[model samples]
Target: MDEQPGLSEQYRRVSAWPLFIALGLPIAEIGVLFGLVPIAIGGLLLFVGSIAGIVQESGYVERPWNLLAGLGGALVVLGAALALSQLPGFSPGAVLAALGSNGLVVRGVSIVVAGVIALGVGGAARFVEQEPI
Candidate 1:
């Protein structure tokens, strides 16, 4: 009988965050280019969440909530810009029209939605505490 030696020690540990992040970016790009709102939003969320996970795993930050919140804020602003820039005017009618038929507006809204989720998750994580009794 023979047994494997040093198998445990030689085993390599890998993180999935980097891979998901890589995949997410391209998916997001494709979605944006093709005007696919759901794809764009899903990709953005996956990418942003992966980043936070990677940062936390790397020990660079004690908590990823802050980073998530920051990324979310940036996304919110960027999305707002994209959504607003398409508008010809600030009138409610114009807004409705753009929202109904504009791809850019749709993408922007998707981004904003992802951002808000990230922000809320991040902010809410801050308040979570685990106590061992």
Candidate 2:
């Protein structure tokens, strides 16, 4: 195969990030629609990780920790709002029931959880930065 002219190292034509990114959202949605916890969690993890990876690979950031943390923070806020919006009232029993039976609550909670995970991962990644010699 002849190499393409002017295709330098900075030009990325192939990457695994897009594949996982494509798969993650639908998988998460499927889980949410069906009220499946594990699938939703897994899908969210894949989705967030892949997003950070793709962003870094595309040269948007030398380190994606800040990006992931920002995303996580946004998710947490949005999820809380969504969950609260779906609530009927503030009764503890009602909340518990909603968590168990309500799809919207489940979706909101899942998003919040995913966001926390992303935030933690991002915070942890920040400390693991490679120091140039």
The best candidate in terms of lDDT: 1
- The estimated TM-scores of all candidates read 0.81, 0.78
For each candidate, the alpha-carbon lDDT, in order, equals 0.83, 0.81
Query: Model 1's lDDT to the true fold?
Result: 0.83
Kindly give the stretch of ten consecutive residues in candidate 2 with the minimal lDDT sum: 1-10
| Candidate 2 structure quality by residue, lDDT tens digits, 1-133 | 2487666755756988999999998998787677687787678778878898899989888877888888888878877777788896656577668997777888878888888988988988788877752
lDDT of 1 at 34: 84
Model 2, position 113: C-alpha lDDT score: 86
Instruction: Give per-model CA RMSD.
Output: 4.7, 3.7
TM-score between candidate 2 and the true structure: 0.78
Q: For model 2, name the residue pairs that clash.
A: none
